[model samples]
Target: IISPDSVRLENGTSLCSGRLEVKSNQSTQTWSSVCQQDFDQQDAEVVCRELGCGAPSVLQGVLYGDVEPPMRTTEFQCGGHESALLDCRSSGSDRTTCSPGKPVGLTCSEPVRLVGGASRCAGTLEVKHNGEWRPVVYSDWTLKTSAAACRELDCGSAVSVGEREESSYRSVWRIRSDCVESGSALRECAAPDFSFSSSSSFLNLTCSGKPSPCWDNLQL
Candidate 1:
């Protein structure tokens, strides 16, 4: 059995024996014993919280042990019109702690200039998790993600990606990416996953000139 935070076994015992790995806060484990004792599957669990040892003394004289879960990172994708999500506060250090139920939400609704345009048009992309909107970080914005955005917005060819800082931003999620292009239908480009750190703050992208603009922008 799997719990949201930790694992447990029968005989009313708290087992801390081996290593386990979970992704997106979801994981599974298999149990098989060579002993002659009958094992109860109902008492075994991959629990999320620490079980009280002094509650009722479940393990009086039984062979039981537990192992810590392995650390994992979940990768998320960004679309052409959407900026990728980021954990701004770095609040949740563990993947299991940052469960999929608590995923990051990002949105981009500000009008931006494509390539070199006189008027700035904009669209917004929002991530829904735990019922809130968190803006995407622009620090690690990639051309692929930006290109996808341009294509999604029918904003012509992607020429560059830029980041801007705003003081009054609601969520401290004010990373802005600028795309430059022409036309009405934005072309689709493969979005890539980017890491967050001090060194990778600026991103630039150049699109392929396919004369007819064959990229699929309708599917989003």
Candidate 2:
């Protein structure tokens, strides 16, 4: 008899829930007998122990009553231009990487990409460093820059720019902007073409542009 939480793949193989442990092939079992089994919490632990699968640390606190499993930060890499986010770390190591197509290591308190610019495997990104949310300044900000920001922010596309809120008379090159994130900062989007303003120590950014994709040299 198997637990209800068990997963039965299309191949007729069943993987019990507790530890994602593989069980005897479903085809080897009689349907009549298998259907009669029941599943419960105790069975969960048994399944995991049998399969040699360790409990997932992320769920240990909520599921197994282990209140302080461990603290960790995740990371991601996208757009193919720059580096990875801040939190992506290895299971047992303090080191982390955001290689091509991976995510960077950004903390929860830090803003990450939400909607657009995750093309080319890596690109520019933003994070709340110090006390202000600032854009990662590359050698220069271009159309690709805006697109990456918009996609990461999940704000559809870049629109326009005017003047900084701190100084409406300042030049566009002198202002920074704020980006609202959707999920990951690796989606595709355009750069901001407008001006942004800020009263606090935050940088001013209000750029608007098209929603076209950046040129991926490898794809074309």
Using TM-score as the measure, the top candidate is 1
Q: What is the C-alpha lDDT of each candidate?
A: 0.28, 0.26
Q: Which ten residues in a row have the lowest lDDT in candidate 1?
A: 38-47
> Each prediction's TM-score against the native?
0.23, 0.23
Please, what are the lDDT tens digits per residue for candidate 2 over residues 96-178?
22122111111111133222224421232434322233343222344444554555444455543112223232222221322
Residue 173 of candidate 1: its Cα lDDT?
29
